[model samples]
Target: MTEQGQSMLNRTVRKRHQLSAESIAKDLQISCGLQISITAVRRELHGMGLHKRAAACKPYITKCNAKRQMQ
Candidate 1:
């Protein structure tokens, strides 16, 4: 990514802290005409000290919801 692109990426990340690499890549493509791969986005994010964390575990159904469904 160019310097401007990198700055844009930083700005984007700052503005939306929960965006994924694929979405960020698509944003860059749409907003700035900067075509980048997900890997590149991830690399840039890593360089910026933004590392990915494992997703939190979620139950398929909450206990309360499951009980309600059974009624």
Candidate 2:
């Protein structure tokens, strides 16, 4: 459990992309034969200060910016 948690923690913290807890739990079950739950994966990730978040979006798109971007 701990080794899996460590690997996931490293990946979530160091990588530009993130994996969902459900997928991680599936991987742990398939790759390592550990039948852990999504909640467990979330708990483990939370222990390492990782949390799920959505990518930030810009609310405003100015006409000048759009014109420049087309070029």
Please provide, for model 1 over 1-71, each residue's C-alpha lDDT reduced to its tens digit, 9 standing for 90 to 100.
78898999999999988659999999889988898999999999999889779779997998999999999
Off by over 4 Å in 2: 1-5, 8-16, 55-71
- What's the C-alpha lDDT at position 29 in model 1? 91
Tell me how far candidate 2 lies from the true structure as C-alpha RMSD in angstroms: 6.3
Superposed by TM-score, candidate 2 places the C-alpha of residue 8 at a distance from the truth, in angstroms, of 6.0
| Cα lDDT computed for each candidate against the true fold | 0.89, 0.71
Estimate candidate 1's alpha-carbon lDDT, on a 0 to 1 scale: 0.89
TM-score of 1: 0.69
* lDDT by residue for model 2 (16-68), tens: 35658877767667765777788887887787777897769976779998888
RMSD of each: 7.2, 6.3
Clashes of 1: 0
For candidate 2, the 10 contiguous residues with the lowest summed lDDT are 8-17
Estimate TM-scores for all models: 0.69, 0.55
